[model samples]
Target: MSDLNKLGLAEARDALRAGDVTSVELTESCLKAIDEADALNAFVHKTPEIALERAKAADDRIKGGDAPSMCGLPIGVKDLFCTKGVPSQAASKILEGFKPEYESTVSQQLVDAGAVMLGKLNMDEFAMGSSNETSAYGNAVSPWRRGNDDAQLTPGGSSGGSASAVSADLCLAATGTDTGGSIRQPAAFVGITGIKPTYGRCSRWGIVAFASSLDQAGPMTKNVRDAAIMLETMCGHDPKDSTSAELAVPNFEAMLTGDIRGKKIGIPKEYRMDGMPSEIEKLWADGAAMLKDAGAEMVDISLPHTKYALPAYYVIAPAEASSNLARYDGVRYGRRAQLAQGDGITEMYEKTRAEGFGHEVQRRVMIGTYVLSAGFYDAYYNRARKVRNLIKKDFEDVFAKGIDAILTPATPSASFGLGEMTEADPVQMYLNDVFTVTVNLAGLPGISVPAGLDSQGLPLGLQLIGRPWDEGDLLNTAYALENAAGFVAKPGKWW
Candidate 1:
């Protein structure tokens, strides 16, 4: 049981069912770890009392012979989701004191499946940044490298804390939201596995919007199976989210065929960019080789619109974000700016928004406002939407041409110094999602699997993308890759 900190989801659950441990004990262990490693800032809200209480309920249910899928495990919930009493800040000061009257559909679904909520994890303010520096609560450190007095590294955002906490063993698995590369990138930065299910697979009912069309809630965990378990508990149809697919949730766990003996994997030719470091390129080449060794036939495919993905995402995401965030104009449940004005309510709105949002958020709001304005709407926003449709259509064409999944690099480079990227041009920072944004625009299921490490000892990852509603295949394929590559390693200095 002392080794429980490194145990995967299946192993941990078996430990509980075999009476080798109790839910309360696991929850207490997590609470202790979180307390001891407070410097990571991995969590924004710690509700140990609520967690223990829920663990007790889970134990009672299990003893009564009625345990559900997740049984008594502890899990971290990203702060973007609304909790009835918990302050859901989205890691931004604008929503600092806001609390919701109801729980998010995904959060409620997790609770229903018997998973204990350990706490609310930190994230980029409304899931914006790639390296997590934009978080209002400060950056979450990667659990991978934390000793010898070096500057702390980012735990990738906007799901940074979710990845950090899970890798550090503060929780069994954590919830994450991906808009652009939020889930997969952070998971890579922290040396873990995360999946962004096909858009509309997981409900977005209570999540703060980044780009409504792009934002998706998914799972981050230590291993592929844990991700599967968490996703099984997360996905379903929800009436509140109009974009949610009405189709029935498939049995994901049962669908993992492990044997990819005859599957065809597409290696998109556009992903092999000129700027990628030689080492990462080697990782990709070796990764494809491993898949070939596992009997998957690899072929080159083209997404000619790939270069347009980043610009398209920047336009579409901010445009939608601008409209959605307008609801937070002081009258609703967010920051209210104090302004002296002779004008009516409009002045209050002007002042409140001006002072509440951070620089990045402000920039996005202004851009969103400009793009959606009457004169520019057709030229910018409408054009971007049409391009987004083309990106999705490209994926549809490739998959229909008989490819089970597509492969690519998660980020152009492995985790660099936090300020190295963020301090540069913001467009340069947006380019980190160059390889990832297209999947989001296409509304596809994408994942990042820990492939190997760069010379700097930073972990590198390869992404696997699947057709809509085919997350099980992606996970299974990642599992096979994991088996072949055998590159699993936690943050060497985390302990």
Candidate 2:
């Protein structure tokens, strides 16, 4: 029990039930790890008191033989999810002091399942950046680094905090919300397992909205089994969120037979972009080979609209974000800008926003507003919507051809140093989501599994996009690929 913080969710659950470890011991171990790893800035708000309280309750339930799969387990909650009385800022200054009066459906579900909350993990402001650099609380540094390099790297954002914490063993698992590549990319960078379930699989109620249609909450864990276990408790139908699917939640962990025999896995030909790094290409090829070796048939597939996905996603996501964020005027909760004498309401609105939002958030809001403007709505927003449907149709066509899952590299490259791309054109930063935006556009379940390391010794992951509502089959295939890859290398502790 010395390294109890290192235990995955499954391992911790088993240990708690076997009486080899108490929930208090496990929670305290994680708390100690969090205290020591403050340099990572993974958890912006540490709730050791609440965690201990929950741990004591979980221990009693386990002693009475009433433990659920996640009972007595300690995990991190993303700042995006509103835990009652806990600071849920979404890493934006606008909502700096705002605390939700109620818990998010997803986080509440985890609590109901007996999971202890360690704290709110850091993330990009309003969950809007590819790297965690946009966070008002400051960047969540990745624990991984190049050989002997001291330059801090990003734990890909906006779920970077969740990724960094889980990767560094600060927590067994953490919740992450993926708008484009937020969850998967960071999970890849940190060498953890993350899945963005098919849109509507998890409720969005009480979570800060970025792009209403694209945002989906998921789990980032140490391994596939831990992800599977955490995902089971995180997803379910909720009346509070009209977008939440009415389908029954399945026991995803129980479906990890890992027998993907005869499963047709597709390799999209269009993912091979120009100037693609040799390592990423080789990693994709290696992932396909692993799937093939797992008794699955591999076929070359065409997502002809793949190239258009990135552009369409940018247009559509920002447009929705503009609409969703319109409610944050000075009249509502959160910070209000100090006004000069005789300042009118309009000035208050403008000043409050100007002072509240960060650079990236302002840029996205402007872009979104422009796209939805009367003169350009049809040209940009409407066109993007049409293109989005076409992209979704592309996936449908591939899945219709008997493709059980589509395999590709999770990220274009490994984790880059902080401020590396941000100072350049923002498009360079946006390009990080090139390999991930399609899954959100199609509303499909996609997972990133740590497949291998780049030449710099940083983790790289392979993505598997599954048919909608078939996360069980998807997890099984990821399980198979994970087994084949055998990627067990962890970051050498420097923080």
lDDT of each: 0.86, 0.94
Best by lDDT: 2
For model 1, the superposed segments whose C-alpha errors exceed 4 Å read: 146-149, 341-343
Q: Which prediction has the highest TM-score against the true structure?
A: 2
**What are the per-model C-alpha RMSD values against the true structure?**
1.6, 0.7
Give per-residue CA lDDT, model 1, range 387-455, as digits (tens). 998888889999999999998988887775667765547888787788889999999999998989877
Tens-place lDDT digits, model 2, residues 1-495:
599999999989998999999999999999999999989999999999999999999999999999999999999999999999999888988897988899999999999999999999999999999889999899999999898999999999999999999999999999999999899999999999999999999999999999999999999999999989999999999999999999998999999998999999999999999999999999999999988898999999999999999899989999999899888887879989999999999999999899989999999999999999999999999999999999999999888889999999999999999988855599999999999999999999999999999888999999999999999999999999999999999999998
Clashing pairs in 2: none
Angstrom error at residue 50, model 1: 0.6
TM-score of each: 0.97, 0.99
Report the error of model 1 at residue 279, Å. 1.4
The lDDT, on a scale of 0 to 1, for candidate 2 is 0.94
